[model samples]
Target: MLESVLKTIYVIWYRELIRFFREKSQWAGMIMQPTLYLTFVGTGIASAMTFRQAPGGTPVDYMTFIYPGIIGMSVLFTSMFSGISIIWDREFGFLKEILVAPVPRWAISVGKALGIGTIVSFQGTILLILSPFAGLSLTLWTALKVLPICALVGFAIGLLGISIAGRMESMQGFQLISNFLTMPMFFLSGAMFPLHSAPQWLQVLMVIDPLTYGVDALRNAIYAGIPEAQAILQHSIAYDLSIVGLFSIVTAATGVTAFNRQG
Candidate 1:
């Protein structure tokens, strides 16, 4: 079982790496988006805002507070866009080749999801690398630990994306599904602000948003010890991870099931 899992992981991971490196512009975008958002969006928002007191009397300057949001948004979109690639694979017959592999169908589904997760985690590394510049008080140890959690969350999102992509019979149809999933999840996820401060409608919308759980989990990780966001995340970590875990299991089950279905 262990060897099978390892082999499955390696095959998908290698294919993902090849795909990522094959396009220079894609890699550049992955590294660029977070940097620009931190330098501009995060800082610009912090500069004009006067934060009220919260847990631990944490002072949220725009950049520091927005850093985690940027990371969260980056991971969310990166993993979700991975579905577009899966669509591309289908168009090019690559997905059929994968489907015909000798491995169990679940292995293939997990492999692809894990591959997407790896890429999304790479994006997180790029974002967090700019942490100090955005006045984020991050440590190497914390950042290292953040990697696995980010990857896991990304994996879960990838599985969800895979299931959605599987039902899309055409590239045009897949585009609509991608837009539908990505935009709503991003906007309603409290990525721009916390749920308590949001309007009642947005708060209710967040009740069904997986991205909210992911953002909360990530915030808890980096801010676990920091004075500002730490209190907010520390209070919320348990609940966030629980939700994230649930998302992972549910999406993975659905994705693997879809992979096993007859075409």
Candidate 2:
């Protein structure tokens, strides 16, 4: 039974990969948005704003601080919309065909989420190669450590997309709802600023936003590589990972629950 379930997951995951690569436009948008955000927005802000000294008394620029957050933003947008594929599958009659198979509903949901998560994670990893331009120095060991974190964050956000997509039948409706949700989540997650000094009301919202922890985890991991920045960064690796892990589990269960109710 376990073997069959695993096989189902692999097949679903593989299908997602094949579809994503076949669509050249998807690659363009995914890579373009993050690059523009990091280059244009990041550069503009870094020039206009003077940041406080980092933990070890080293002066840090706004661009350097916000780089990880932007990476989080990239993952957030891509993974959160992974459910659009589900809507597409449903509309094309592929999903209905899969549903009649002997595989469990939870497995299908998990598989779709994992597949999208895997692809988005790889995309984020490729983006990481540009970190040096943001003043982040990545050693072989650090790169190895960051891989799993990126994948987990991807999976967590993919579950969110699946949960939302499961209830949505129309692509247009999904796009509208996803855009509304994505903007606020990105802004509240502190992707463009530090949450430590945010307004109380904003801080409260950030605490409740699951993506906040994911961004914080990315920030924590990036800062871990910088000795000078270590003191100023507030979140510990363990704390950030714990929050993100819990969020993943909750979203995974939510996706499963929602998919189970599907006809």
Candidate 3:
């Protein structure tokens, strides 16, 4: 049974990978958005505003501060939209075939989430190439540390998209719902600005946003080498990881439940 489950997951994951590779346009579209934001938006903001509190008082600029948030943004957008592929598969009658297969439905959900997560994580990592431009000093060690956090954030967000997609029959509907959710999640996640000085109502929403912890975790990892990192971190690394991990578990279960219902 374990072997069967593993094989099913592999098949589903491989299929998603093949589809991703075949769609050459996806690479450009995904990479371009973050590049534009990091270059245009980041540069403009960095020049206009002087960030008073540089982590460790080490003169971290606005661009450096928002880099991890930009990575989170990339992961968020890519992972959330990835579920639209499910709608496409359904439209083409491919999902029906998969649903009728003898394998466990949960395995299918896990595989789909993992596949989307992997793709999103890769997209986030690609943004690391812009670290220097963002005024961040990144090394091989920093990249290694940042990779898994990106994967975890991607996986959690992918499961969320899968859970929503499992219930959505139309691509338009899925896109609409995802758009409604993505913007607020990104803004309140402290991606573009610090949350410590946010308004009370916004702070309330920030705490509830899973991406907040994911972004914070990314910041924690990215700033790990800086002195007095805690000055910049809202929570400890372990705490941030715990929240994102819990979110992933909850979303994974939700995705599996959605699949079971659909199946």
Scored by TM-score, the top model is 3
> Residue 237 lDDT in model 2?
76
Models ranked on TM-score? 3, 2, 1
| Clash count (model 3, backbone only) | 0
Q: What is the lDDT of residue 12 in candidate 3?
A: 89
The residue ranges of model 1 lying beyond 4 angstroms of the native Cα positions read 1-6, 53-58
Taking the tens digit of each residue's C-alpha lDDT, what string does model 2 give over 1-263? 99989999989888988999899999999989988998999999888877764545577777778888888888889888888888988888898888889989888878887887788777777778888878778776666656677778888888888888889979998889889988999999878887766889998998888888877777777777676666646577788889889989998988876667778
What lDDT tens digits, residue by residue, belong to model 1 across residues 132-201? 8977667888788678777988899888888888767677787788788888888777667767667788
Off by over 4 Å in 3: 53-59, 228-230
| Candidate that would win on lDDT | 3
Query: At residue 183, what lDDT does model 1 achieve?
Result: 85
TM-score of model 1 vs. true structure: 0.89
lDDT of each: 0.78, 0.82, 0.86
- What are the candidates' C-alpha RMSDs? 2.3, 1.7, 1.7
